[model samples]
Target: MYTLILVLGICAAALFLAGFARGLRNAVIEYRRGKPEPTEVPDYNYVGMAAISVVISATVIALVGVAPMWIYAGPLMVLGTAAGIGVAFFVERPSA
Candidate 1:
């Protein structure tokens, strides 16, 4: 069970990275095309991001030997992912 969790965590991380890369690529393409703004990511991107959050949360719980994994892990993952997404957007935004 633990091994399965770890494997899932790794896959989730990979998927997050891939989605991030894809979003970035599309943003760049739009910029190069002189579009006024980058396109919003689709629902699938959010799903991928959510998967990553859950995976990270699960990994943290497993590493710390915590019980009731959902209690702490879920909120932490949500907060962490939100902050991460904000940072990504801020960094990628056009400078005034």
Candidate 2:
């Protein structure tokens, strides 16, 4: 179970990185082409939540002592996945 979670997390992280890099490259290209700038900056509520989730998960692991990986891994993985989803929502949110 722990190994499965680890692999899933790694795969998700890699996919996120690849997508982020591609989006950033495209944004730069568009900016260089003189596209109009966004009218408003986005709020970072999701990002903040994601950060908080990670911090909470880390605190849990630290307190629990992960020498028992099976016991600790479930909650940590759930929190981590929630964080990732929060980030995805953050990126996809409309500027306001």
Candidate 3:
């Protein structure tokens, strides 16, 4: 039973690593193929800018000891949510 579990764990780890390596390899290939194309810059809307600015302001405030946890937390969450939804606008799409 122990041997079986060990073998299965090794197999799972190997498969996971192989898949991760393949993804990195594909990303490199796609990046190389995309080099000739013009990349679109991610434009920040007011809300996006506000989120980023809030985070920056919070960090600066923290350096001054005037910031609370929520000061950073709220802005970080805002940026995190925005990044989740808007990452496609920034990243290069691989050519078919």
Candidate 4:
């Protein structure tokens, strides 16, 4: 019973992740097509970005742990995937 539910949850998460990856790839391709290749390396705070990601992951885990898996897994995964796909579109190229 519990084992079956866990398996289903894992499968659903995998499918959502695959969709997100596909959307991300398409978004990157579209973005590149609209912009020229950069002449200079972009400055980014890699450590800060990683730390923020870790904090968000930890917060999500804590919130999800409070709910029954069956109640939270489906909607949260769907919403998360949708949000990720939507955000991919915001990487706009500057107008000419």
Best by TM-score: 2
Count of clashing pairs, candidate 2:
0
What is the clash count of model 3? 0
TM-score of 3: 0.35
The segments of candidate 1 whose C-alpha lies over 4 angstroms from its true place after superposition are 38-96
Error of 3 at 90 (Å): 25
* lDDT (CA) per prediction: 0.61, 0.65, 0.57, 0.62
Tell me the lDDT of model 4 at 13: 62
lDDT of prediction 2: 0.65
| Rank ordering of all candidates by TM-score, starting from the highest | 2, 4, 1, 3
Please report, as a residue range, the 10-residue window in candidate 4 with the lowest summed lDDT: 87-96
Clashing pairs in 3: none
Which is superior by TM-score, 2 or 4?
A: 2
Model 3 per-residue lDDT tens digits across residues 2-50: 4654565565555555655555776788787775655676775688888
Q: Rank the candidates by lDDT, best first.
A: 2, 4, 1, 3
Q: Cα RMSD (Å) per model?
A: 10.1, 5.6, 11.4, 7.6
C-alpha TM-scores of all predictions: 0.40, 0.43, 0.35, 0.41
Candidate 4 lDDT, 20-43, residue by residue in tens: 666677667767788655677678
User: What range of 10 consecutive residues in model 2 has the weakest lDDT sum?
Assistant: 87-96
What local lDDT does model 4 show for residue 64?
74
Comparing 1 and 3 by TM-score, which wins? 1
